[model samples]
Target: MPTNGWDTHMHVTDPSYPEAADAEYTPGQHNLSDALSFESTIGINSLVLIQPSIYGNDNTLLLNALTKLGTRHGRGVVGFDTDATSFETLQAWHQLGVRGVRLNIKSNEVNLTEAELQERVTRYAKIIQPLDWVLELYIGMEDIPKLEPVVADLGVRLSIAHFGAPTLPPIGNRTLPLDPYTVAGFQSLVNLLKAGKTYIKFSGAYRFDKDPQYRGIEGIARELLKFAGDRIIFASDWPHTRFEGLDIHPFVEKCLDWTDAAGVTEKVFSRNAHELWDIPLDK
Candidate 1:
């Protein structure tokens, strides 16, 4: 790990068992104390706690964990309904060290429509812009095309989840699907990076590859890194959802190997996180 490194992405489940299945995945169980141990082993000095979808908009558990972890070791990314979360409430979260908001559109659990989606995105942009917080998208790659125009229209900085959600085998072939809309979305990400309006997290290789070892995903990551290495950041996606069988450290090590440092590893591992999330470090 780079000196004073921070893991830009992580999640902690709620402490209470509102639902038995959800409770199993709680941060108190999978992260919290466990994360400190993992950080020690990995040499990451700081971390960001993203609110897991299991908790929906109730960020109390995540916030509690952040409070316990303390500012020196933690920051947060919360989830909220743009229609429901008022500006004052958002400002409070910002003061609590929340540097970003997560738009978990992929799960479809929240069930938003095109109009509602656009409205929420706009509202979030309006609220977070003054604080300079980012909007993080966790959705399918195909869906990105539908969402790009709104993001561009809003003039807010955005982060696409999982490396532009590249289409590879078991999803789409290596060449990427030829759908014009998808093509436009992928190009939109490149354009956004070129214009310095967006960023991508080089995380969750397990989510992209059908193979457990993540053999071919590196090509997609390199493609993004080629265009926006400085803007790209790395993440462990700790307690990887549905991928508990694999060792997290080895996956992280493989990602490090795939990138080959190329002089960009430092940025991916630490520097970009500092710039994007305002993570404090000794350097």
Candidate 2:
């Protein structure tokens, strides 16, 4: 393992904190101590606690965890209402180790027009540009193409979650007919990676491939590694809200197999995300 390995994406759910009224999923309690313990067990030095969608724009739990966990060992990616949030609050969150804002379009069907979605991300990009932060997205597999130009033109770092959430083909073929939106989105994601305009998180293998060994998912990982190995980062996706009772070790090991190059896991697990978020490495 690299000395400063980081789990770049994960969530913390506390029952006491209460989920948003409109939350699509009712998450059971998963808190700061549990997260810290998991990281320790994995021998990782730092972690990035992403604000779960259950909390909506209220990031009290995430900020409190960052404060308690200390900035050196923790970072946060929070959700906010760009329309109502002030720059001062954004700067304050930045001071507390928040380096990115999440735009989770896949959580629920937002019923928004493409123009509305574009306007929303554009506003967020403008707000965070000064802080040099990333816009972390959990968009649907098909929406990637629609949002590609907005993210590219916004001039801020963009990180796509869940291996770009590729639309899977039928088993055995490795290549098959794909829906127009899926094909377009996957191709756009590849083009963006080639241009060094975006980054991908090699996390949530279970989301893409349900096999215990994560067999079929490797094809997508291989493609990503082939295109932008340097831009891919690893995350445990711990406390895997929708998918718990799944051991992370196997998934963690799967991250290393994405590329055959020596020390590739070291780069994806430690260097890529640390550099992207400007986390200080242990000497």
Candidate 3:
């Protein structure tokens, strides 16, 4: 772990908060203490608490965690009803270390038509423009091609979770055909990277590969590095809801190994996050 790095994505669930009635899956309870403990063990000192789909628009748990961690050690990204959330509410959250909003499309089971998707992204982008915060999406690889045009020139930063959460084609019974070129919407994703308004998170390898170590996915990272290593951000994807029991120790090493070879380990692991999220640790 980068001792001064930020885990830009992760979630903490408290059972006291009511779960969304239609939550895709309830996460096993992971407290703020537990999250801090694990990250400390790995040598990571900062965190970003992402609002899990199960929490819907309720951010009580998230706010409490942020209050405890404060801006010096924590920042947050929340999920909200775009229509219902007020500017005052967002401003309040901003003061408490909330730096972004997320569309839980993948986990919340959103199936917007291409036009609907475009409109939605536009709304979110426009809402956060004044706040200088990012608009994050939990969409899949296939959605990237559809998402690129809408986000390309939005003038606000959009961060994609889990390397686009790409589901690559299987090569054979024993081999993984994990090439980004073989994946849908990859070029569109790269196009947005080049356009300079997007950030790609190095996280959720388990979503791309079922292997515990997430083997054979370096092609995706290398290609991402090739196009925009400086824009890449590393995250722990902590407690790893939906994909439990994953040994992330080696997986993180693999990401570093690749970034080191590309000569952007510092950028990906530290500098990019400090810039994109405006984390204030160094100051």
Please tell me which predicted candidate would have the highest lDDT against the true structure: 3
Worst 10 residues of 3 by lDDT: 169-178
lDDT tens readout by residue for model 2, 1-283? 6678889999888777777888887776778888878888788858898988889999998898888877888889999987789999999999999999998877776755778888888988999999999999887666776776676689788889988776565456444222323443778788778878688998887876666766667766766676587899888899988887778888776676555453477778887887888786551
Q: List residue ranges in candidate 1 displaced over 4 A.
A: 19-28, 109-116, 171-185, 281-283
Question: How far does residue 256 in candidate 2 sit from its true spot (Å)?
Answer: 1.7
Q: Which digits, one per residue and each the tens of the lDDT, describe model 3 over residues 1-283?
A: 5557788898998666688888877678799999998887767878889999888889889999999999988889998888899999999999999999998788766788888888888888889989999999898778878876677567689889988887765534325435668777788888888988889999988776766555546678888898698789999899899876667888888988989889998888888988888786482
Q: Local error of candidate 1 at 190, Å?
A: 2.1
Segments of candidate 2 deviating more than 4 angstroms: 170-184, 260-263
Per-residue lDDT of model 1, residues 1-283, tens digit only: 7776778788765455463343334334575787677778788868888877777788887787788877776778998877788889888877778888988876444556667777877888887888888888786665555665577777578876677666555643544322323332566666667777678887787776776656556665656777688788887887676565357777678767755656677778888888888765454
Model 1 per-residue lDDT at 35: 69
Q: How close is candidate 1 to the true structure, as a TM-score?
A: 0.85
Q: Considering only N, C-alpha and C atoms within 3 Å, which residue pairs clash in candidate 2? A: none
RMSD of each: 3.7, 2.7, 1.7
Return the lDDT, model 3, position 171.
Answer: 32
What lDDT score is found at residue 5 in candidate 2? 84
- Would you list the clashing residue pairs of candidate 1? 13-27
